[model samples]
Target: MKLKVDYKKCEKAGECYYNHNALFERTDNGFPKILVEDLTTDALRHEAAEAIEVCPTGAITIEE
Candidate 1:
């Protein structure tokens, strides 16, 4: 699976970080920091979907 966060639409609510710190984090400016790109692991796929669901700003998307 492929994952990408739209920084332009992101509100930096930190839901992604709260759920998976190992996969996501917040920058010093409060924006989301995606640790992995183009994830192939099952764990990462689940986590990325979670992040997309939890993102309040609708900034996350998954690509197959």
Candidate 2:
């Protein structure tokens, strides 16, 4: 699986950080930091999905 974050639509709520900091974080100005440029593990994919869920702007997408 693969994950993609749309920086344009990101609202920077940081819910992904609360759920899984390994995959996402907030920038100094308060935007989600795209941590894993390339994710090949199931664990990382799961966390990415979690990030997608909480994004207020629906900025994240997962591809299988």
Candidate 3:
């Protein structure tokens, strides 16, 4: 239910956090960091989906 990131493919574009700051954060190095606990609700999941879609590197995913 949490979000995961594949660092190998991440380019630190800051898109995920930019699209959904409540669920993710931009680290000092520019990588996206998960900020929420669990995406148990539909609204949160939908927001996560939008954030995932904005990832140009396709590095973020749902950790079920």
Candidate 4:
């Protein structure tokens, strides 16, 4: 699986970073930066899905 972000649609809510710091990081301006690209492990896939769901702007997407 792959994780993608729509930067234009991102609201910088920080939910993904807050919930999954290992997979996502917050920029100085508070935007979410993806720490990992391809989710090769099951754990990462699950976490990515959770982040996508928590994102209020629906900016995060999972490509399977």
Cα lDDT of all candidates, in order?
A: 0.83, 0.76, 0.88, 0.91
Per-residue alpha-carbon lDDT of model 3 for 1-64, expressed as tens digits? Answer: 8878899999999998887999989899998788885898999999888988999988988888
> What is the per-residue lDDT of model 2 for residues 41-64, given as tens digits with 9 covering 90 to 100?
877877777777787788888866
Which residue window of length 10 is worst by lDDT in model 2? 11-20
lDDT for model 4, please.
Answer: 0.91
Model 3, residue 9: C-alpha shift (Å)? 1.0
TM-score order of candidates, top first:
4, 3, 1, 2
lDDT of 3: 0.88
TM-score of 1: 0.86
TM-score winner between candidates 1 and 4: 4
Predicted structure with the largest TM-score when compared to the true one: 4
Candidate 1 vs 2: which has more TM-score: 1
In model 2, state the lDDT of residue 52. Answer: 79
Per-residue lDDT of model 4, residues 1-64, tens digit only: 8898899999999999999887899999988889998999989998898998899999999887
lDDT of model 2, residue 56: 79
The weakest ten consecutive residues by lDDT in model 3 span 31-40
Q: How many clashing pairs does model 4 include?
A: 0
Q: List the residue pairs that clash in candidate 2.
A: none
- Stretches of candidate 1 off by over 4 Å are none
